[model samples]
Target chain A: MNIWLLIVGVGLVSLCLRASFLVLLRGRQLPERVTSSLGLVPAAVLAALIAPELLYSSVTGTLDVLNPRLVIGLLAAAVAWRTRNVLWTLMVGLGLLLVAQGLGWR
Target chain B: MRHPEDMTEIIPHSPQFRPAFWRGMRAFTPLVPGVVPFSMVAGIAAVQAGFTPAESIAFSLIGYAGSAQLIASQMVTSHAPTVLIVLSSLIVNLRFAMYSASLLPLFVGVPLPRRWLLAYGLTDQAYAVTMGRPVTEPSPAAYYAGAAALMWLTWQSGTAVGALVGAKIPSTWPLDFAVPLSFIALLVPVLQRRPQVFAAIVSAVVAVAAHGLPFRLNLILGAVCGVAVGQLMQRWQAKSV
Candidate 1:
């Protein structure tokens, strides 16, 4: 599988998914169950994506609670929760990570 | 709750498309700086995986997805099979379908071609920004196009810069962590109720516990289970209330 081909395939797959409802449904009413399920998509999917990044060690590929990522990510989560601001969450999160690394805490 | 400074009244009420576009762009400006670093990390990862600068930039253009691009780059470096890479990347992106479904009501009157284009440009940030606006908003397609235009430009430029100068970035900078941090910011506002919170918790736990599963099955499993839990919780809350 050539990388370029892979890219194209992935692009097409993504476009199809993104277009699935918008194109196919065409303003038609989705089933109520699906509409409700769609509402949870962001929370559920984002949490699934974020969890491994925060908990799993990047290098060792195992659950490590004390990893700098976990500590700093939790702090970042707090910032996000408190401020409800993307800029603040990112700045504080990355800032904490950089500082932890600077202090050789990893 | 229209803003006092809203100029909609002064203009002839023909659905102010241009203003909505600009409003979308302005609303998304704060997140632009944050997006650059996350995109840069994607570019750097691609280059580090032996993709040429041009190829890395191509990946950004063709894929146009942040997390999936990053995962694909890693899988490529590890010599993972192309099928697995594609499968995993698609799994990561399945949430976009949900976004498409949820946003369909807003685009009902939009033309077919424009809706297709809008769908192509759908990203988490742009979707979130557009959805954050008042549901009664006019010119939503214009607004989405505006935010997505800015987002696309920012991502392409940042990836270009990262790929061109990726080797110089110190490993200690922790640039990759910025991706998850940004996600946290996006996730927090969505967890406004118990059902959503419960969904997130269930999703995270399931994903983590299934970490050893191959081909990114865990993520799909986690998301499905989470949505199911959330649905049940919503019904239970309604019954109780």
Candidate 2:
């Protein structure tokens, strides 16, 4: 496989994956069941991605329930829950993360 | 209890497209710091992997997928076969399909060229910011444009800078933290309904349990399970009601 073919192949795969339903499925009849289920895709994907990051330490390969990320994430979650402000939630979460890491809380 | 997704519920005046677009842009601003470093790293990595400046920029534009770019560049540098490189990158990017499917409802009404552009700019961060947006956002096309256009520019410039700058930048800064932080902010508001919560919990558990899955497929597994449960639960609740 030449490098150009590789690029074209991967590009085709990605474009198809991204554009398939996005462009093709427009005005298409989605089943009621599928629409309801698809709504959960964002929640499921986000949680699936977030959980392991917070709970399982990427650096240490250990699952620390008291991982500072988990604790501070919960704090961030609280801010998000109460204020529902994007800026606040990020400021609080990342501020604490930097602070904790800076203070040597591994 | 107002969710960020719900904040735009009542438009003070007549609905317009530009405001929603700017709102999407504003919502994505906080994540820009993180985006710069990640894209820079990929740019740097591509250069280190022997890609010319032009190829590096092309990688960012054509691949447009972050992890896939990183993985592909690394494989290319390691003298890996093109087939292996392509396969690995494809697997890394399988999630985009899910992103595409999820955006269908919001984007189906958008015109042709605009929809094509949106599809081009569908990164994970943009999707999270846009999908987490309120259904009543009036003009999702504008909101998505605002959010994704920034990402497209940031990514392209980041790659160019990193490629041209080339390995001089120290990567020690914990800039990577911002990506997950951005997601957490987006995730909290979606925890509104019981089914959504349940779906999240199931996904979280399975993601952790299957964290060891190869190609990081466990994320997909968890998503599928969570979506299935949420759908079933939604039906059950509707019946009960």
Candidate 3:
């Protein structure tokens, strides 16, 4: 398949997924249980997305317990927990990573 | 009764809309720095996957999803089967469906065309920012539009700029790690309740454990398990209290 076709196909899939509930279930109320569960979707999915990135080495594609990303990520999480500030969390996380690299820790 | 179309006209002009809209923009502004580099990584990755700048822009616009864009570009580079490419990318994006569901009630009376626009702009940032508002906030649709608009602009431009110049950036910079760090910042704020905290923990554990799943199924599995565990915890907490 052509690259454009492939891009459109993937795009359509994304659009469909995003539009599924908003368009399909318009004017209808969801059950409370489902709505409540959906409330957790943000937390659950974001965590799911973040976990593997932190634990697994991007370069090696393997689980590394001592991955610097994991360590810095945890520190970032603590900063986020404390500061509730995006810029601070990012600065601390990236700054620590740069420091670690500078020290030849990899 | 207000016609839905009338709502489209009035909503944006309503007294509540402008402030809420600007508030949404302001709320999302802090994350822009993080979003740009992450998007640049997506753009850089697309270029590395042998796409022209134009093709990369088209891919970014079409996909409009950061991680999915990364995955799709990777799959395309590997010449993976088209079906597999779409499936894997869609798997990575399945969370959007849940986001849409969560947002359904908020847009109940919104017009069809506007709903389409809202859905098109559905994203982690928009959802988190809009839903993170206090329960009694006015002009939710407007707030959503505001947040979504900023996110859309930031993402599109970031991706375009990245595709154009991201190739020059050295790989040694660890810019890719910024993606997760930004997410961690966003994720931490949303986790307020015990159930939400447990949900995040459970999902992370499951995702890491199920990391072997094909086509990024581990994410979906982790989210599902997390939601279930969260629901049970909610009931448990309620009963205990």
lDDT of 3 by residue, B62-157 (tens): 889887777666556657667777776676677788788878778757777778888999998888889887677767787788889999999899
Evaluation by DockQ, superior candidate among 1 and 3: 1
Docking class of 3: medium
For each candidate, report its DockQ versus the true two-chain complex. 0.60, 0.37, 0.58
Q: Between candidates 1 and 2, name the one with more favorable lDDT.
A: 1
Sorting all predicted structures by TM-score, with the top scorer first, yields: 1, 3, 2
In angstroms, the error of model 3 at A85 is 4.1
Clashing pairs in 2: B21-B142
Query: What TM-score number comes out for model 3?
Result: 0.77
- lDDT score for candidate 3 against the true structure: 0.80
Comparison by TM-score, 1 against 2, better one: 1
The digit string of per-residue lDDT tens for model 2 on A1-106 reads 3656666766777777677677766545557776577567667877886788789764697888877888887888788788766567667776898788899875
Deviation from native of the Cα of residue B166 in model 3, angstroms: 1.7
Instruction: Using lDDT as the measure, name the better of candidate 2 and candidate 3.
Output: 3
- TM-score of chain B, candidates 1 onward in order: 0.76, 0.65, 0.72
Candidate 2 lDDT by residue in tens digits, B58-158: 88888787766765665575577777667656544666766887777676445555566678788888988998887678777678878998998988999
Q: What order do candidates take by DockQ, descending?
A: 1, 3, 2
Looking at model 3, the pairs that clash are none
